[model samples]
Target: MSVITQPTDLLRQQDPQMADVLAGERQRQGSTLQLIAAENFTSGAVLAALGSALANKYAEGYPGARHHGGCEYADLAERMAVERATALFGAEHANVQPHSGSSAVLAAYAALLRPGDTVLAMGLPFGGHLTHGSPANFSGRWFDFVGYGVDAATGLIDYRQVQELAHAHRPKAIVCGSISYPRHPEYSAFREIADEVGAYLIADAAHPIGLVAGGAAPSPVPYADIVCATTHKVLRGPRGGMILCGSEFAERVDRAVFPFTQGGAQMHTIAAKAVAFGEAATPAFATYAHRVVANARTLAEALEERGFAITTGGTDTHLITADPAPLGLDGPTARGMLAAAGIVLDTCALPYGDGRGIRLGTAAVTTQGMGEAQMAEIAGLFAGALRGDAAKTRTDVAELTREFPPYGA
Candidate 1:
């Protein structure tokens, strides 16, 4: 019998059907541009760690106090992940165990508030994530979540309204950060409101953790009592979640994560996260984070020049939300048209309940080594695709993708 050293080769020989699907996915990613605000490409090193032999372990508890034995290596991996995460975000403590962003949010709520307690967060339709307060999600099902939205005219958060709501409700927690708002949160302002109401402040930095870690955006650790983030998004790690908090709430957070929310942690993903955090702490990542924002600004400006309506006039982060009605299209229609043309993004409901809006991000493109010039070109493709010239636009998209291949091919 031959030794199956390479997993891919073994899969090809034993399960050709699944292998084909994986190959197809690789081709698709390489051929198309990924503009999803919550998506990015992890480095090859991160991928290697994710597929390491650590996946076979079963470390059920914290590093030192495990439920099972034979966990020395698992303990090392978890400790390294925690240390790197705390160092990267400047947190007093960090938990890299929750399975996803939703789990992290749930654990935070469980540790901080009672099931029926009132919590304040952004509305789902107004650039906020489903996990924030959507009725369909677990967060809204358990807690009384009052939502706030951006101002209609300025398309910005109304700090006065947030403060007023906090005063009236006196919520147990106030959640900041958004998935599609395009502007950074005023953590200091939220902290002040939380202080006045005697509420804990939770900042969900899932979308901008890389920017925050790289020093391109303001850190929320100073203002937020607890911060929850997904490691996969801008952090460019394996798909996992993390919780960062001060020493006061560290034990509560750890208990909430283990035995309460998740069972044994995904050690392989934690290993990958450790690698990613190390990469994010470097000076090169700071440059990439700044470039991500610069590219987004260029893309927004280029789209505006083409008669598109950009929310808030432009962007301050790596994302841009645009009203597609100018092109005689709704959000879903625009999304479909762009998908057919090989450009990928998301369709979102407009804040004021108008028609719909389309969201684009620069993180994945920037990771692929795209710059301002590429952003301009991508905007032109969007215009052409929405203007009933998808064929030509698709050709141009293919050409451009070839120039900036995913993960450098």
Candidate 2:
């Protein structure tokens, strides 16, 4: 056996049960299409970092100020992550400690607003994340959140309404980001509105941060007071959260992430994030990022041609949210049919329609070396799957996946 398979072999020797489950998951991932909008496969180097010995270490607080002893290596890992993150996103300061995207958003709110303060964010039903203002979330329970919606006709952000809300509510902060909206948010317009209302601009860039790193999308670092993002998604990093800000807000953001919201930093994940940040800065990553967008546009167009209602008419990034109502399938039904055909994706709210829609992205498929031709074929597969042709569609999907295995044979 080679180094790649040695770990599984060792695990099987000691813990056969977990080893089997892990092996099954690996098989499932390679066999099925990973079209989830928030998912991507990280490089082997990043995975190696995650499995490093740092996972056993317990390092609390920031680098050089750790509350525990024997943290010299931990400090080095965290410093590398912070430096790489700042350079990749062109931010003055970066915090790579938040456990997930929601944690990052929590830190941003903690640093900027007090409990019960007014905040303006996209409404939950209009594709906003739970951290934005879902009543069940800490954000909505703690703060007074005013929700914004998209233009009913265009399925686009209603900037005019946002401005009016900002002026009327006098919110302490304004959040500009979403889970299903496919277009880039106009950061400048958001800045103008926040400035007009004397509110801080907090950009929850969990989705587009990867494209920003690859130069495929506009960055919010310049316009927002604080930016919260996930390290994965289109960024192709490990699962982790990151916060970027100007030097003025750096300390507050860091403190909020450290003592206020979270405790010890996961040194292994931080190391993995550093490796991912380094990878994302390369020329190849930029090409990959742009290709992700190209593939998404192609897929969106192909799906539209197949009778699905493409949201916002199309996509500007890796994500595409489309209503499958034309095919007599709602989002959940479409998702079930796709799963039967070995295709995987998520269901999301349709801003301009009556029911839910399916949300997917090209990041993983593009990473697997798929191109425009493959995207068109996938659309055909989607149509066939929704028509209840599960066996044939699953067989074709397996054949296509075999040609472009996520990891080489």
C-alpha TM-scores of all predictions: 0.97, 0.98
Question: Residue-wise lDDT of candidate 2 within 228-264, one digit each (tens)?
Answer: 9999999998999999999999999989998999999
lDDT (Cα atoms) of all candidates against the true structure: 0.88, 0.94
**Residue-level lDDT tens digits of model 1 in 136-184:** 9888788999998899998899999999999999999999988888888
Using alpha carbons, what is the TM-score of model 1?
A: 0.97
Q: Candidate 2, after superposition: displacement of residue 10 in Å?
A: 1.5
Best candidate (score: lDDT): 2
Off by over 4 Å in 1: 1-7
